[model samples]
Target: MSMQTSIALGKQYLLDTYAQVPVVFAGGEGMYLIDEEGKKYLDFVGGIAVNALGYHDAGLSAAIAEVVEKGLLHCSNLYYNTQAIAAAKGLCTLAGMDRVFFCNSGAEANEAALKLARKFGHKSNPARTDIISMVHSFHGRTYGAITATGQDKYHVNFDPLPQGFSYAKFNNLESVKALVNEKTCAIIVEPIQGEGGIVPATVEFLQGLRELCDQKDILLIYDEVQCGMGRSGKPFAYQVYGVKPDILTTAKALAGGIPAGAMLTCEKANEIFKPGDHASTFGGNALAMAGVNEMVRRLNDPEFTDAVQQMGSYLREKLVQLAALYPTLCGEVRGMGLINGMVLTVSPRKVVDACFERGLLVASAGYDVLRFVPPLIVRQQDIDKALAIVEQALASLL
Candidate 1:
């Protein structure tokens, strides 16, 4: 279908939640999306860090195809399936956790984590149900997730939200300490805040949180939804900081673009949830687990993660140079690994549109930050091309 026709139909039928771009993507190859008109756009957004292997990856495609051919996409969580079992084992091993609960999205994973935290706390004392989240953090869109999110913009109109949630300043250990009390059950944070303009947590802050959690017996949770699955130059962002959480929620790129999420728990937090406490029907669907199995195997490779670290450094250097060239237009360049953001003096929407026109796909973190989360397989040449278009877009705005 034509781009206009497709967009018109979408506008008429689909929920008006997103202000989508005009282009209609037909398919994707390595590092680029082909539009309906056969216009190839460099995809630096990586489907919001969901396409970790880029597109049309041979191994991922074959794994998923095998699952489809088996005709066991979902056998229900009541019975055991090889795909789910293997995927669970692989994820737990990769994350260095003891057990995992599968879900369908980042929001679901976070919801499960929150439930686990509350239940674990209740085991000790009923009043210890409060959760402390960071300011400017984005958890997910579910009721519990939205309530845990620190941004007021997402909470608007969603009144009478779930109680027992409070926010502290990101990277401020003192603020977190001030909020902590006997009621605090858990503290959730993103090692690298993805939607909060790609700000990474400081080492001292994370270490301090870990120490405090140990002392107070509070469960520390890291939401690596956007930064996990090799996007952060490691299997998980918390590994980079050398601080382990009692529970970790991961999704987005976990299933290599397939819809999957997981709430992983260490030995301390593993036994909190019994069978009836929480469950998801399609949480560990065979098809999604097949994708997860392949993704985890590929992401675990040392060569692959090493390349990510190298390319992340290269990308950061290029972005720093871009900021230097236009000091007035851009501010600090902040990120770890491929997930990055450039603080802009002008509206990020204007620059994003200009980049779209130039056949480069990027996204904005908030109002003034341009987010770059290219696929892990993105090469130096692709980065050069995308940055050229970004420079062109910035110049156009000027």
Candidate 2:
């Protein structure tokens, strides 16, 4: 089908939510996506960090095809499946968590984590149901997740949100401490804020939060939806700082592009949710679990993670150079691993569009930050090409 025809049909039938780019991708190979017109665009955004292994991966594709051949895509949570069991074991081992609850999408994962925190808190005291989230943080679109999000813009027009949720200044320990009370049940944070401009939490801040949570008997949750699964040069972002949380939420690249999310819990928080407490019908379907098992296997390799670290440093060095070259158009360079951002003095949207027109795909976080989250398998050469296009885009803006 023609790109224009497909877009016209989508506009007529689809919900008016996303301001989508004017391209319809037909297929992908390695680090590039082929549009309907046979144009190849280097995909730096990686479907907003969902395509970790990149497109048409041999192992992931074979695993998914094997699942398809089995013809048992979903057995539901009523019965145990081997694929789910294997995936869970791999994830638990990598994350150092005792248990996991699978779901579809990052939003659902965050919802499950929030529910678990509330229930765990209620066991101690009914009034301890409040959750503290960091300011400028993005959780998910669901009621509970959105309410826990610290940005007012996301909450606007969605009135009468769930109460007992308050915002603390990002990286400000005092702000978090002041909000703590008997009613506070948990504190949720992103080690590196993806949607809020690729800001990494200070080491002292995360360590302090851990200490505070330990003293207050509150659950500390890490939302690794965008930064986990080796995106941070580690199995999870918490490992980067060596500060473990009681609960960790992950999705996006969790199932190798398959729609899946998981809320992993430490031993203490693992016992909070009984079988009847929370459940998802399509959470750990065999199809998604197959992908998960393959991804986890690859991510567990030390050599693979080491490459990610090296490439991340190479990408960061290139971005720092880009910022220096265009001082007027760029500001601070922030991020860890592949999930990096450059503060743009010019409008990020214009730069993004310019790159899109030049056969590259990038995204914007907040209003002025250009976010880059390429596939984990992205090589140094790919970084060179993407940054060349980015430099061109910046020059055009000038």
Candidate 3:
């Protein structure tokens, strides 16, 4: 089918919610996507950081095929599925948490976390209900998740939002102190704020919050939905700062492209639910769990995680070198792992369009921040090639 036909059909049938580009991918390989007519593009966006292992990974394909051959997709919440149980155990073991609640997406995982925290707080004290979040932090698009996000742009359209939500400054301790109160149930934060220009929290800031949560008897929630599952060069980003959360919500690459997520908690916090305090209809389906099981096993490997760390360092170093050469377009780069962004005074949107035209798929976090979240399995040579494309696109702007 022609791209125009596909777009026209979408315009007629689909909701006008997304500002989609002109490109429509036909299929994807390891790190490349082909258009309907067979124009290959090097994909660095990774489906907006969702495709962890890139497209059509062998292991992931095999896992999905096996699950399909078994003839199980949506095994309802009645009986236990092998994939769900094994997937949960894998996440629990990797996260060093007590239990897990699997779900279909990041927003769902975060919603589950919010529900769990509210219940835990009420269980401890009925009046303790309010939750704290940092400004500019992007959680998700759900009603509850939108309310929890500190950005006003997301909150402007959705009024009468859920009460008991507060905001504080990022990377500042005094702001967090000012927001905490007796009614506060939890504080949700992303260790490295992804959508907010890839800004990372200070070590002292995270450690201080941990200590404060310990003293104030409040649940510490880390929304690792974007930064977890080997995106941050570790099984979890919280591990890098030597801090742990009472509730850690993860998604995105948890299933390496399968629609899956998880909510993890300490042993004590796991007791918030007895037999059935909360559940999801399609939370831990057999197919999603099978994919998740494979992803979890691959990520749990030390060598794989170490390679991610090395790739991240190499990419960042290359960025720094380019910055030195071209200070006009490239301002600076910052991130924990493969999730890095290059700050610029020029419009990143234009750069993104230029890269797209050059057959390099990337994304922009903010107006001036060109974000680069390549697949974890992207090779060093691929990084060099991507940088060359970025360099060409950036030089044109200069």
How much lDDT does each candidate structure score? 0.94, 0.94, 0.89
* Most lDDT-accurate candidate: 1
- Residue-level lDDT of model 2, residues 29-109, one tens digit each, is 999999999999999999999999999999999999999998889998999999999999999999999899999999999
Worst 10 residues of 1 by lDDT: 1-10
Q: Candidate 3, which segments miss by more than 4 Å at Cα?
A: none
RMSD of 3: 1.1
Q: Cα RMSD (Å) per model? A: 0.7, 0.7, 1.1
Query: How many Å off is the CA of 301 in candidate 1?
Result: 0.7
Report the Cα lDDT for candidate 2: 0.94
lDDT of 3 at 85: 95
Candidate 1 Cα misplacement greater than 4 A, ranges: none
Off by over 4 Å in 2: none
What's the CA error at residue 154 for candidate 2, in Å?
0.6
